[model samples]
Target: MSNETTTADGGVRKKGKLGQRIAYACGNLGQAAFYNAMSTYFIVYVTGCLFSGVDKALAAKLIGVITSLVVIIRIAEIFIDPLLGNLIDNTNTKWGRFRPWQFFGGLISAVLLAVIFSGMFGLVNVNTTLFIVLFVITFVVLDVFYSLRDISYWGMIPALSSDSHERSTYTALGSFTGSIGYNGITVVVIPIVSYFTWTLTGAKGEGQAGWTSFGIIVGLLGILTAWTVAFGTKESTNALRAKAQKNGNPLEAFKALFQNDQLLWVALSYLLYAIANVATTGVLLFLFKFVLDNQAAYSMTGVIALVSGLIMAPLYPILNKRIPRRVLYIVGMTSMIVAYILLGLFSTNMTVVFIALVLFYIPGTLIQMTAILSLTDSIEYGQLKNGKRNEAVTLSVRPMLDKIGGALSNGITGFIAVAAGMTGNATAADMTPSNIHTFEICAFYVPLILIVLSLLVFMFKVKIDEKMHAKIVKELEAKLASGEIVDDEAQTAETVEAIDEEAKTLTE
Candidate 1:
């Protein structure tokens, strides 16, 4: 779908260029690569290896405390996401609000990614209390920068194009690249952490130093990709923001968020999906290390995720044309549940496990891609209903839900590890058969349940289908052409001219 803008010359212009799609999609690869490494492996590093060989009791306690902190920090983002969104909305600069934040956020997040993994600044060597403080501080800072980049980055989607097809195309590209960057590391990280050893210290591959070295490489790569996005994609100001700003109620920004029905439903559904998705990824390390007794299988599972996304990404726009997003959501959720059940039944068989994962992730790709597209469309829904576009605040819902879900999943992983005596120097050999089963339950069943619950929220609440979206875009375009949507500054200038003309006539 061409994002048609009614030009001053009464002509329509297309906004989504091929180059812009490639550039914007490239950023996802960088950002996801950096973030995925941390979200999936950071907790494993801390609980599984960082405090290894300490007193079993002390190590367990430390894992508990640090895990708690991770949860708290993520929960805190519920407040932080919106505030950052509001800030992003209010910001004005020559570079554009989104790019400036995207560039700086990506840069800072890249540096912090290395720092977080490096365990530098005395974080790894410090006592439990001090480590928690440092960890929380670093995590929060990284999250803030991440939010700056994420909110601005995805927020730009609505600005990129208003057409549903165009939005989904960009979204699919982003999802495709992001899944690769995000899940692709799962294929390599474990192998690197498990088998590849650095020459400097000859430490084990999964050891602290090895993970730190890995982080540095990933962080630099993220910086490069992020820069690709910053320089490559151009954001158009001719979006919902024009009319939304005219109707913007700064003081009511927070309240306005809840009032947007499309945003609300999409956000709520994403919250559940994110929790399930994050938890499942969190459990992969344990699942590979403990139940499967081979860390290399992580790569295989990661391959499943990556391949499924690859297969589905290109198919999304095609599939979406045929199926309603709601139906797709249901099918995806149901497929995921069935796959998980099959995975649990065939837990010991690697071949079956791989097959089940392949099935699970195909729909998983659909779920992820559509969620992003849905959120992008919600910006128009908000603008149409509220008379103001809160793109940043609205887009912030993803990270907000993501962080919340990640926190829950991470917290659960930590608690499960502590309870099963898997924390602090615990290896696959140390776990009993029952402990392996517990890992499976966390890895598969919990997420299965969450997906089902989210499906409920999606079916009942999210009402903006493709047809409705098309109608919204058409109406908005008509308004723009008819001059109902006016720029605030331009309106002010026109008002000033009218007053001046009247004054001149009276004086004459």
Candidate 2:
């Protein structure tokens, strides 16, 4: 027999099937694949392949200009992400606010990515100034669509489940699948970009034509993955949106999300972690080539990391039952710090390097998995505290920080490259001993410091531990079951007192 029930909002409520959860989570695979490709390889393409055959000195100058523009675009996202998030929250449609955007956004993103890699500007022999302007404009447009899909996509996590353990399950599955997609690109990108030949010349010459072809394929793959989520999972038809729709000021709703104390702490901690993580990955290619003396090792490292994550993914839900999130965070951060130090100290030893990479990733994945659950818990906290639910706006914190972190990572890596004289010299063969040292310091030590700082912030500032989360969930569920709307003033006062009590308990 089919199970169905009606919520107080007069909308149908039912648990999403396992198949739906798996399919919806699969969307992350494509999203992660596309994002990882761009963040990890796009700069490499611009600096190395795009300018192939051009004068090295001239190309280097142009690359500087491009990198600067890229950084600016990323900074622009800091403002853009929240606004897009607000728009998504305010949006209401028969098909749902998220799936439409996910479908169309992924579709447009594919086309734009293909266009970027198509080398059409080369065909037209566009002037350098005109090409840069057009490329920047195209990239911005592409990113806008990406944000649309991303914000809406992740927003669905809380909307998909109100239960904390369920959120952990979905997030863990998403992270696992997403890692597959991400590593798939990392492992094969080199071969894909060199598999075929065309009239193109320079670094790989006509072989670089494969980039455009690969872009097209990946683009289409993105669309397929998006559809899996769009068609599969069912979003909660909660009364929250109906209540939000009654108030038309999206800006107020957006502001209210940041005002949530728990969410604020979570976002800050996640932002720091994201910055350190992406920044370290940003410099790995350089480290592999110049320091490790094996470009292929970069892909191997990525594959091993992803495989480690896959093995560790199932363990998170099990561990969540036994460990407090605060303890988990501490353990993960401590493990990562130790791994980074070991990797730095024994940089030239292949066995140590491989072992360190594995050790780093296992706990890193655990931390990420737990962070997702914690963030979802904060959604309930916001609702209980603020008398409103803004899933899209609240969840947007992750993507917003992601963009900021990526931009900062790029800037950090770019500076290190320039300082080491690696920027002007494309190939690792030109790297001096001093350059290698600088690379090691920037890639390893800098990220270690950043992560250390992240741990401190999370440990002291973030207060939503397992006990606190349980309290919030119990109170919210009770409030829902009562079917009585408490007065705004009274609700706010009670929320404050309850949260304060939890804080006091945590301290005691």
Candidate 3:
């Protein structure tokens, strides 16, 4: 949705343009698809096969251990993702600072994914005293490349366009298209795994061999899909390009987060959302196996994705027009809360569970997209307040929170499973009523609780809205034009003005 306003000289305009909008959409689509793969597939693939090997319970433990290791590798990423982002923020190339990173980042990540998958298959001989070590090393390699690709990928958004609205629109586009890839990958994974495991086999069948092949295919697609954004999008800012020439301290770039309160809130809020999202994705296997009664033949989750995705765009416009973003976002998070609670409470009926999946998708997509748009807006507020533009640093928070939250969620889920007795019975063809309790919590309680908490951070803690951001933008533009420092007069005036406005209210 576009908001119209008159400038200081009374010229009417909307904040962002269409080109930047499209570019943001592509970048997000590419980025989202890449992220979706890790959440939906990686752990499930690992544990499902290992369960057939050694003791199923021990295999579950192994899956938890390895996936947790992958998650831990991601923590090291707190330093790495942003470091890549900072490098992109400070780099200057004829090709532009952000896109170059995207191109190489996507290509490199895809390559490493292949290695990760290849290693997964050959891991039988390797699954010994050195099992954990080899798996950790292999996954970490791909994880590092993912860090490079993800940080460089998202950092492009603020650098590409200065308009808050454009960032949202483009973010929506990226989200929409990327959902295609996201859902597509899951859909394909469902059939592909089923096919390889069921079809490609000797007396031993495919076993581990099948899953490994699946990883290879997933990795190749990730590489190509991510590269499309790097080459397809462009950056609009010139000031940032010039900023690269000064050779300022790299530490100062990340230091922007502590100094900018709006950005800090955005990052913190993102962290909360990331936990809910990762948990939601983490439970896909549970939903498919027990929630759907192990109808491994037909792909119910893939169907959920296709149906939910069809309505995401129109749903966004309807929610945005009727509810303030805050309320719309609340509706989205609350939907997840309700969906998960229901799943935990009474999901014995596959029919009802399937229906709830539909309900869950609309709000989940809405909340995810809205949170992303909010992050872009937060960056604009950061530039408005500080008068120093650092898109990469400012925008890095999304991916930063994503990996951090994901790591935390993985650690928690693994711990939860171990405590709840997921030893090997987690994937039993017939789950007992007691085990169903554990599955319910994983699917519903975890996601619903996290989302409700996220909404609390957003609704009660966040202060800025649209009006406040517009006013800040107007004042910052004027200051930029006149070289008037945002000193006592301007700072006090804006601070007070911020109180009277909307969108991004945390002027602190």
Candidate 4:
């Protein structure tokens, strides 16, 4: 028999196990790997591949166009993500709502990951117009499965735990595991395979053999990672809320989603952070090549340091106990400020740049993990305020921001890099060139400035902390149990905490 039942508020209520949460976080390794590889290295890979076989200027333009197209496709995903979320909400599988979506999304993502760099559609011989057409189609198709899976993956975060501390721990776990493994593999290890293939194929070209092989390897890994997550994830029945039988039209649902305020702020913060992140990640090639003067070490050196920041993520719950989420956001933004300033001012010595990268990413990484946890908190906030659990709707914010940020960043960054006059082989020795100079400025200066500004935005913000969250979750559970309007506001904060702590004891 079907297990889902409707709560008075029309939202699904369920709890997942600790083991499932751990599996879910591990499964997220693929997501992190794909994102890190694509955002940081994809443009560089394409540039190298094209330069080996084609003109340098033309190759730059080709990379720019392809990057811009990927961004465009990403922007389109804002619309697709919510639709995918609703479908998962409505779905019923013996395997559960989320796992099936995860399975299909993984399979599709793996196939396309390899296809994007397959050389099945040779780039060297294709005319500019033809190149644009084929590349756009392939990249857009890649985004489709990507957004679907992305929406489903993050949407499940809240399902893992209702307790504020547990949820923060889960988010931190995902961040920590993903940061170490993803960066380690993508940076330290990826080039080994790429370089090896380059030797084997005797494809003396820049990255034709390397990237094509790289894409295949990353894709196969993604498939395996995704499969593990799908098989292991336990989709507990939503002890509350009935599943929808009718399929949703994507546009109508977006209109409905647009009206959600908690969702709106989460979406906004995500969009801004994404813009900052994409620009930072996208500029690495230019920095190592032109600013650091080491083309070979460009990929790993500064980036590897960001892993230090991930270490701070698991400290979130403890910090949240002492500080509000908004304050934590400010802290993150402040750390970013110091990091960015160091890069902008003292990015000279290898040691200075390495320290700078560590400082910058640590706070940046905190904000990265915090944003989702805060948003998950808001999903509870959203439910209390709006009377609908619509967990998937709130989760859609990640993708919506992703698409907007990716599109704007990708397109704008491409054009910006070109206008700045950055070229393919821009080693530090090449820094005297004007575009390379602009590339350096945009890379360090822009992110630094944005960090200070982001801090300013949260100065007056109100956010729930550990105590406040306990009260909130307790009130929701009491109402769900009693089926009566207990003067929710009549209960003092102390009273609410007492009730919540009591209820949790019962649950345990």
Candidate 5:
């Protein structure tokens, strides 16, 4: 029997099963694991381990170069990501548009990640120039493929279900599993690296071989989970969806994105939130190792984040029912502000730090889930306003903003480590009071300021709430019934401009 059902507007939507939701959620697990390994730990490995055998001055210079490369490449990808999204939107294949990209992109990026983590097979010690060349090549390819997979993976959310509540459930489940995969890295990396180091080289400390092994293990896990997403999930198909799959000029899709005022506001707000949120991650290991001199306790933060996810992930849909997203966003941001204050005041106390993390994460998880829902909801908003549903293009904004934020974070992290003399072969004993102070300012205070900006933008600029979204959906259904909205590919420039003017006037 067909799982598809026709809506009042005569459009078809697929009803997903529990297993399909679980399978869709699994994609985030692999993606987050793969992403965190690169975003959170790759720099740490480069600064602390990859350059340990090189000359001090040369290593410092190399770190600077590598950091520059990372930031530049990620920034470059911001432009490329939208095109990739359009490509995905235009894709039609036997397997499906999203799944093929998810599978192949994930698989190839995983392999490249493993190879990159292997430090290009120790080429640096033998030939520095060759290592840099290969690093550039591999890293660029890895990032591109990773972006493709990320876009396709997230782009599936709206396609899974158009109902707001069901969409929230999927987003929350993905976030929950994704946090486990992302934060799980922090919890397991030290133990895994330590144990593997001992087993491989009979050493009790971190080594190249250990890091390489960790990469391979993560890669394999990524591949397996991505495969599950491809084989296990289903995409909703209808006349509209089928038409959307037809090839169109990416420029039209890109222009339509700017017409959606709500999407713009959400995108801007999420960009600030992402930068503020991710900027602090790279500094956590340094904080535990250099400031507190307790490397092991770093994992506790991850555990707290995971525990918070366990508690808050399921709570989102419940809380969302009773509270408006704007209110929830404000509450979460306010909690994070308090958490930062506590962290800053009690930097040296592990107990206080752990408490601060708990406070930070519970709300932090809520905020992330809300941001995702906001972004997802904006797709419908854009469709209503622009008369085109560029789901991949609209959703692509999230990851693009993430990469920009992550690049900035990497730059900040690398700069702090080098300036504080916390890089390669440095010990906690070697850190002066001034160095500790620098780390504190960059790690704690900077993100605090960014978080405030994010909250302000969200509170003031973003206006869509549950009530508004329901209204928009109802209007869209009417438009579909009246034949006012048609295939997005057939949307003409004059028609879109007319709708944009009407939308602008309505807002005013």
Candidate 6:
């Protein structure tokens, strides 16, 4: 069956085959698994296992350095991501622009990630300097390649379909699968690491060998999903895209990106939300291990997240039909605020904690879906205003902001772990009231403040809604049909065909 579908407005749109859509969604499965493993637990592995054998003072110093290094590298990536996005935007090949990057970049990064998780094969205990050097190099390279894969994977969404509802379906599916990948790791990591660590070394808790094995598994999953996207999905091409490619200019694209007011507003709001959300989630492991004194209970949080994903992901499209995205965004943020407050007041109560998790996650998923749709729509807003489409560049903002958030979260998590004496052989029994207070301030209060700010920014500044987007689409379609925004290359090809037909008529 053909992948194309007819829209209500009589436009030919590529909705993609169900199989293709599923394949595209699978890209996020591996991506989230790989990313969450690193973003959420890499620090845990480093502080708890990798440096466990070192002297306490020296290990503390090294952890500080590593945390700062992670923050610096991710902050530096802020500059690199846009350039990579521009590169993806300009890329063209027989296999299409985004897939090659998604496949190869995912493959290489997944391997490097396993290397990172390996703790340099126990080199930290043998030669700390060499381990540090190799860690930095491997980490930087892994992040770059992963960003390329992430940017390209998301960038392809706009190309798949122009219909807003269809775009929401694609976004929802990807987000849902991504949730499964991320939370799936959360659910299984403790048990998996514990079992493997025991099997490999007769260790009592998580160890280097176990972490390494888990990393390798996640990496392989990443590779498989990347390949699925590359081979199973398709990119839709058109005159506008062809025209945009011909005149692609990175510098101009950057300028155009900033000029799109709607994009900037949505990006800024989402950035705030991402930083707060990630920072909170990133510290959950530390919370469970130290505050609650039940690291195994951490997996239940993931179970809650999975349930939230199942409900929220499918509900987004349905809710969106009846509610404005702006309103949903408000509701989600408000629910998170309430959850944080609940956690802050009664964190030691496992039942309250679990209930807060449910409240926080269900709405959090809705907010994420809303933000993604807003960002996707802003691409069209930029195109309508600038007369060029830079899907990769625009969508790159999502991952870029995410990295920045992850960077800050890593830094925050590292600092809190150290300050609260939660690192290296420390148990919840070791934590004092003071340590728990510090954790609460960073994990709960700080994020609460940020989420509130994010809500305010979106409510006041972001103007694009369903009605506005539909109007923009109508105007763009009218302009395209009237040749008011014609593709010069496509026009030239048409002119050549006309001339050839005229010559044949004269000969006849």
In model 2, where is the ten-residue run with the lowest total lDDT?
Answer: 483-492
lDDT (10s digit) by residue, model 3, range 1-508:
4343444432233454565455545555545556666655555555555545576656665666677777778788677665666676677888777667667777777665655555444555455557567667766666666766676666665554445544454555666766676676666666676667667664333255566667667666666656666666565543322332332356766665666766676567767777866776666656555545564623666667756765685456555655667777777777777677666666766776776777777665677677776666665465555445666666666777887877766665565455545434454455566766776676567667667777777876676655555665666666655656332222345753553354433333
lDDT of each candidate versus the true structure: 0.75, 0.74, 0.61, 0.63, 0.83, 0.84
Off by over 4 Å in 6: 9-12, 486-508
Candidate 2 structure, TM-score to reference: 0.91
Error of 3 at 120 (Å): 4.8
Cand. 6 Cα-lDDT: 0.84
lDDT (tens digit, per residue) of candidate 1 on 349-454: 7788877877778887788777887887767655555446678888888878877877887787887788776766567789887887787788778888888889
In candidate 4, stretches whose alpha carbon ends up further than 4 angstroms from where it belongs are 1-19, 120-128, 203-206, 238-252, 299-303, 321-323, 481-508
> TM-score per candidate, in order?
0.89, 0.91, 0.84, 0.84, 0.94, 0.93
Best by lDDT: 6
Displacement of the residue 51 alpha carbon in candidate 5, Å? 1.1
The reply for model 2, stretches above 4 Å from the true place, is 1-14, 123-125, 197-207, 238-248, 423-426, 480-498, 506-508
Clashes of each: 2, 0, 16, 6, 0, 0
Q: Which one wins by lDDT: 2 or 6?
A: 6
User: Which has the better lDDT: candidate 1, or candidate 4?
Assistant: 1
The weakest ten consecutive residues by lDDT in model 6 span 487-496
Q: What is the per-residue lDDT of model 4 for residues 1-508, given as tens digits with 9 covering 90 to 100?
A: 5433433334333344566667787766777777666665565565545444677667776777677667666766666777777777667778866777778888887778776665545654656677677767777777777766777787777665566666677777777767765565546544654575668676443556666677777777777777777987875543222222332455545654664454555556656667776677666656666666765776564356445645576677677778766667777777767777777776556777777776666765667766777677766554444345656666777766756755655665566556655555444564565665566577767766665555554443334445555655666665656653232223345644554454345333
Model 5 vs truth, CA RMSD: 2.6
lDDT of 2 by residue, 190-214 (tens): 7677665443443443234767777
lDDT of 2: 0.74
